[model samples]
Structure formats: C-alpha cells, structure tokens
Target: MRVLVTGGAGFIGANFVHQTVRERPDVHVTVLDALTYAGDEASLSDVASAITFVRGDITDSPLVDRLVGEADVVIHFAAESHNDNSLSDPWPFVHTNVVGTFTLLEAVRRHGVRYHHISTDEVYGDLELDDPAKFTDQTPYNPSSPYSSTKASSDLLVRAWVRSFGVQGTISNCSNNYGPYQHVEKFIPRQITNLIDGVRPKLYGTGQNVRDWIHVEDHNTAVWAIVERGQIGRTYLIGADGEVDNKSVVETLLELMGQPADAYDLVSDRPGHDMRYAIDASTLRSELGWTPQYGSFRDGLAATIDWYRANEGWWRPRKDATEAKYATMGR
Candidate 1:
C-alpha cells in the first residue's frame, strides 16, 4: 500500500512514519512537509531513506492534489500547533489548520482516496465546573482558544466533505501527547529543559489546567489501527486514559530530577487558557480493539524526564529560542 503523510517531519508525524516503515515493510510512504520552525528534518534522520520526503505546503492546491492522487491513503498531521502562538497570531492557524484542511479534503474528494485527520481533544473546550470533561465523538464543540477553535472548524469541514462528497475517511481526536522528538516549544519539553537549565519553569495561572496525556508512539499506533480497519465516516478518540494536572505534572518531573517544586515560576496564563480537557476513549477501544502501551501519568512523567536529560543537544537551542521569544513578548 502507498501512503502520503502530511507534516511527516514534525513530531508525531515523524513517529508515525518511522513506525509505519518498521511495521509494514511493503508499504511505500511519501511525506509532504513545509519544514516550518517546529518541523525539524533531523527528527526523521534515522528513517529518512525508507520514505520519500517532499518539502511543500498543504495549501498548495495543485501540489496536494497531485500527492493525494498518487497515494491510496493520506494522513494529515500538519498545522501550527502551539497554543500560545495561536493566541498571539490566529491568522496563521486559520490558514494552516482550516484552509489547508479544506484544500486536502477537496483533493481527496476529487481523487477518491482514503483519508485520516489528526485532531485534538482541545476542541471540546473545558469541562463544566461540576461535570466531567471527557469528550466523545458526539460532544458539541466549545473551543475556548483560537488554536482549538480552528481545529474544531477544520473538523467540521472534514465532516461536511464526508457528508457532501462521500469521502472515505476517519478522524481521531487525541489528548496531549508527550514522547521523544517533540518540539521544545511544547509544554512538557519546554518545562523539562527549563528546569534542568537551572531556570524556573513557567506555570500559567495556578497551574490547575488538566489534560489527558498520551505517548506519541501509542497515539501513532492508534492512528495506524484506524487507517487500516476503522469504519469510514467515524470519529475515534485516542488517549492513554491518563489525566494530569499541570502543576502536578511539573511537580512530578521535578521530583524525578531531584529538584524542588519551586523550580518553576508562576507566570500569567495564556489568554483564554482552557481550565481542563479530557476525552472518552471507549469508542476507539471497542471499535479498533486498541489500548495504550505506555506508562501512566506518573510513570510517563518519569520516562519523559529521563529522555530530556539524555537529549540536551536536541532541546537546548529550542529552549534558548523560546526564552528569547518569551522575553521579547514580556518586553
């Protein structure tokens, strides 16, 4: 089988490509990536030769159309994914997440190919004060930030295409992912690098925001299952069923490193930060017979810390960039 993985040079996308090549030696994989700041080709260094890489944007209608026509399957993982970045400049997010998705959907419809969309649990917004926040396939979108709002809009576009054009496809909304090769700008890696550098990690608000955590490898495995055996026009929620309070996650990482809780500094929260996000994975489990294969929240935190400690060169430069950007914003 031939497949096209958009954003294949990014964190989760790269992981998916590596795993796909290792598991299915016969499958030919093509990657289309724009190599944005967050997407480092270095992440896929070990698996480079096994797959074809194209540096291109998803919104380039002709390029996407041609790639979609060539492959039997298309897995879209490209987007401007940082929440703070979205809050500061939403236009880029809309263009990549919403417009780019529409472009791909149109291409798929015209070409008649199987497609899979990688979405996030954040689109469901924060849970009510007294209610559980686990989002299901049927949950109404209540996005609280521009980043999630655009993702929600993109999800709607995919559903509309399916309903209108009978596009053969499936969707997976996953929780916060943490594992190797994640960009240092993300929360987990940013905090890990900061704390280890003798700098205080920044905690937004009271750090009470809660998010379900999944290892990238487990998330990629779930995606592979859906692409292979999932029913068309269905949405699956993928997660490790592990939820961690932001403060507690930071504290756990500190403990593993023999550092103190005060190793972090409390900063003003991002605008419209969702209080908590969660997801119900029962549908994915029953339909795909899939479950996570990773450490729990606490154990995952431990493992993540060790990874950052061992890969300083991979994260230090990004950490410096993050600090410079944050410093300029503060100024």
Candidate 2:
C-alpha cells in the first residue's frame, strides 16, 4: 500500500509514520509537510530512510494533486492546530484548515483516492464539568475557538465531498493526545518539561477544565483500523476513555517527578476556554473491534515524562521561545 500523509513530521503524524514503518513493511509511506513552526523534520529522524519526505504546503493545488494522484490513501493531518496561536491569528487556521482541506478534497475527488481526515474533539465544544454525556458520532457541531471552528468547517467539507462527489473518505475526531514528539507549547508537555527544568508548572484558570486524554499510539492504531475496516463516508471518534482534569494532571506530574503536589503557579486563563471535553468512541470500539492498549493514564504519562527527559536534545531548542511566548501573553 502507498500512503501519503500530510503533516507527517508533526507530533501525532510522525508517531503514526514510525508505527506504520515498524508494523507494516509492505506499505510505502510518503510525507508532505510545510515544515512550519510546529512541524519538525527531526521527529521522523529514526525512520528517515524508510519513508519519502516532501516539503510543501497542503494548500498548493498542484503539489496536492500530484501527491494524492499517486497514493492509494491520503491521511490529512496538516493544519494550524494550536488554540492559543489560532486565537492570536485566525488567518492561518482558516487558510490551512479550511482551504487546505478543500484542496485535498478536490484532489481526492479527481483521483478517487481514499482519504481520511484527522480532527479534534473540540469541534463539539465543551461539556459541563458534571455532564455525564460525551461526544458521539451524532453530536452536533459546536465549535468554540478559531482553531476548532476551522476544524469543524473542514470536517463539514469532507462530509460534503463524500456525499456530493462520491469521494472515498473517512473522518476521525480524536481526543487530547500526549506522547513523544509533542510540541512543548501543549499543556502536558509544557508542565512536564517545566518540572524537568525546575520551573513551576503554570495552571490556567482554576485548573478544572477536563480533557479526554489518549495516547498518540492508541489514537493512530484506531486510525489504521478505520482505514482498513471502516465503511466509507463515516466519522469515527477516537479516544481511550482517559479523562483527567487539569489540576489533577498537574498534581500527578508533580508526584511522578518528585515535586510537591501544590508546586505550581496559577496564571491567567485563556479566552473562551471550554470547561471540559469527553468522547464516546463506542462506534470505533464495538464496530471495529478496537480498544486502547494504554489502560492507565498515569502509566502512559510517566512514559511520556521519560521520553521528554531522555530527549532534551529534541525539545530544548524550542523550550525558551515557547515559554517566552506564553509569558508575554501572561498565561
């Protein structure tokens, strides 16, 4: 099988590539990435010789057309994905998430290639902290941030393409992913790296905002299961049933790192911050026979801490700049 992965050098996409190369020797993988601020070529360093890398933007019609034309499947993961960054400048989010998705849809429609879109659970907006309900396939779209709005638009585009143009495609909205190669700008990595550097972890708001966490490998495993076994034109929610509040997550990190549970600072909260997000991935689980391997969030988190500790070389260069950006925002 030939697979063309957009944003393959980024954290989650890079992990997908590493896992694919290790498990699926018959598959030839090609990565198309813009090498933006969040995209790192070094993330794919270990499997450098195993896959082909193309440096290009997903919005380039000709490049996207050529790449999609040659592939049996195209997994779209390229986008401006940070909520903080999107809130600062929404143009990149609109251009990359909405326009780039349109570009890919057109290419896939023209070539009749199988396409899978990667999305986030944030598109359904936040659930009240006490709500037992979780986001399901039938959940209505209710995006909060510029980042998620664009993602929601992209998801709609994929659905329209499938119905109107008969494009072979599937979509998956995954929960918060934490694993190796994640950028330090994200929540889990920021706190983990801060503790490693003897800096206090910063908590936003009251630190009660809840997120459904999932290991990147588990999420990607579900992605592959959908590609291989799922019906076309369906959307799958990928999660591991790992739900943790911000404060508790920080406390766990502190405990694992041998710091006081309360060794953290409260900072300004982000604008329009959602209270919580949860996912009901029953469709992917029961229908596709997929289940998470990471049964314990703490165990997965501890492994992630170890990865960042051992890979300081990969994350150090970006640490100061990320923290500086956050500092200037008073977050």
Candidate 3:
C-alpha cells in the first residue's frame, strides 16, 4: 500500500510514521511536511531510509494535488496546533488549518483516494470543570481558541466534502497526546523538560484545567483502526479515558522525577483558556473493538519522561526558544 502522511515530521505524525514503518513492512510511506517550527525532520531520522520525504507545505495546492494523486491513502496531520500560538497570531492557524485542509480535500476528491483526517477534541471548546459530559462524535463544535476554531473549520470542510462530493474519507478527533518526539512547546513535554533542567515547572492559571490524555502511540493505533475499518463519511472520537488536571499532572511528574510535588510555579492563564476537555470514544471502541494499550497514565508519563531524558539531543535544540516565547507571553 502507498500511504502519504502529511505533517509526518511533527510529533504525533512522526510517531505514526515510526509505528507504521516498524510494524507494516508491506506499506510504502511518503511524508509531506513543511518542516515548520514545531516540526523536526530529525524525528524521522531513524526511519529515514524506509520512507520518501517531501519538505513542502500542505497549502501548496499543486504539491498537495500531485502527492494525493500518487497515494493509495492520505492521512492528514498537518496544522498549526498550539493554542497559545494561535492566540498570538490567528492568521497562520486559519491558513494552514482551513486553507490547507481545503487543498487536500480537493486533491483527494479528484483522485478518489482514501483519506483520514486527524483532528482535536478542542474543537468542541471545553466542558465545565464539574460536568461529567464527554465529547462524542456527535458533539457540536464550540471552539474556544483560534487553533481549535480553525480545526473545527477544517473538520466541517472534510464533512462537507464527504457528503457533497462523495470523498472517501474518515475523521477522528482525539484527546491530548503525550509520548516521544513531541515538541517542547506543548504542555507535557514543556513541564517534563523544565523538571529535567532543574527549573521549576510553570502552570497556567490555577492548574485546574482538565484534559483527557492519551499516549501518542495509542492515538496512532486508533487512527489506523479507523482508516482500515471505519465507514466513509463517519467520524470517530479517540481517547484512552485518561483525564487529569494540570496540577495533578505536574505533581505526578515531580513524584516520578524525585522532586517535591509543590516545586512547580503557577502563572496567569492564557486568554480564553478552556476549563476542561474529555472524550467519549464509545463509538470507536464498540464499533472497531479497539482499546488503548496504555492502561495507566502515570506509566505512560514516566515512559515519556524517560524519552526526553535519554534523548536530550532531540529536544534540547528546541527547548530554549520555546521557553523564551512562553516567557514573552507570560504563560
């Protein structure tokens, strides 16, 4: 099978490429990525010999069209995904998340290619802190940030293309993913890296914002399940039922790293910070008979911390700049 993975150099996408190359010998993989700030080409270095890599933007219509035409399947993971970045400048998010998706949809529709869209549960805005409701595939989008709003726009575009143009595609909105190769600017990796450097971890607001977490490997596995088995024009919610607040996460990290639990500092929250997010992945679980491999969030987090520790070379280069940016934003 010929598989084209957009943003395959980025965090979750890179892990998906690694997993695909490691596990599926029969598939030929091609990666299309712009190598943005968050995207590290080195993430795919270990698997460099096995796949074709194209350093290009998804918003480039001709490139997207050509890549889509040659693929048996396309899994789009490209986007400007950081909520804080989106808040600082919404234009990039709108362009890449919305226009880029449109470009891919046009190409896939033209080529009759099987496609799967990777999205975020943040598109459903956030739930109340005490609310028990979880975001299902049926949940209406109520995006709270520029990043998520653009994602919501992209998801809607995919849905419209599926229904109106008969594009053979599926979409999955996943919860927060933490594992290897993740950019340091993201929440989990940032805290892990800070703790590693003997710097106190910083928390936004009161550290009470709840997020449903999943291992990136689990997320990619679920994506494959949906790609191979999901019905066309359908959407799936992917999660592992791992929900924890920011404070608990930091405390656990401190515990794992042998530091005092209260060593972290709390900073003022970013604008429009969502209170909570949770995903109800019952449809995916029941229909596909797929389950998350990471049974314990703490165990997964420990493993992630180990990755950052053992391979400082991979994340160290990106660390200072990311923290500098955050310092400017006071996040």
Expressed as tens digits, the lDDT of each residue in 1-331 for candidate 1 is: 9999999989899889889999989999999999999888887888888999999999999999999999999999998899889878899899999999999999999999999999999998888535765789998988888899999999999988999899998899999999888988888888888778877778888888888899998999999999989999999999888877899888887887788866777887778888777789998888789988875777767777888899887777677777889887661
**Candidate with the greatest lDDT versus the true structure:** 2
User: What is the TM-score ranking, best to worst?
Assistant: 2, 3, 1
Return the TM-score for each candidate structure: 0.96, 0.99, 0.99
lDDT of each residue in 68-165, candidate 2, tens digit only? 99999999999899999999999999999999999999999999999999999999999999899999989999999999999999999999999999
Predicted structure 3: lDDT: 0.95
In model 1, what is the error at residue 270, expressed in angstroms? Answer: 1.2
Q: Which residue runs of candidate 2 sit more than 4 Å off their true CA positions?
A: none
lDDT of 2: 0.96
Question: How many pairs of residues collide in each model?
Answer: 0, 0, 0
The true-versus-predicted C-alpha distance at residue 274 of model 1, in Å, is 0.3
Model 3 Cα lDDT, one tens digit per residue, 298-320:
99999999999999999999999
Candidates in order have lDDT scores of 0.88, 0.96, 0.95
State the displacement of the C-alpha of residue 317, model 2, in Å, after optimal TM-score superposition: 0.6
Model 2 clash count equals 0
Sort the predicted structures by lDDT, highest score first: 2, 3, 1
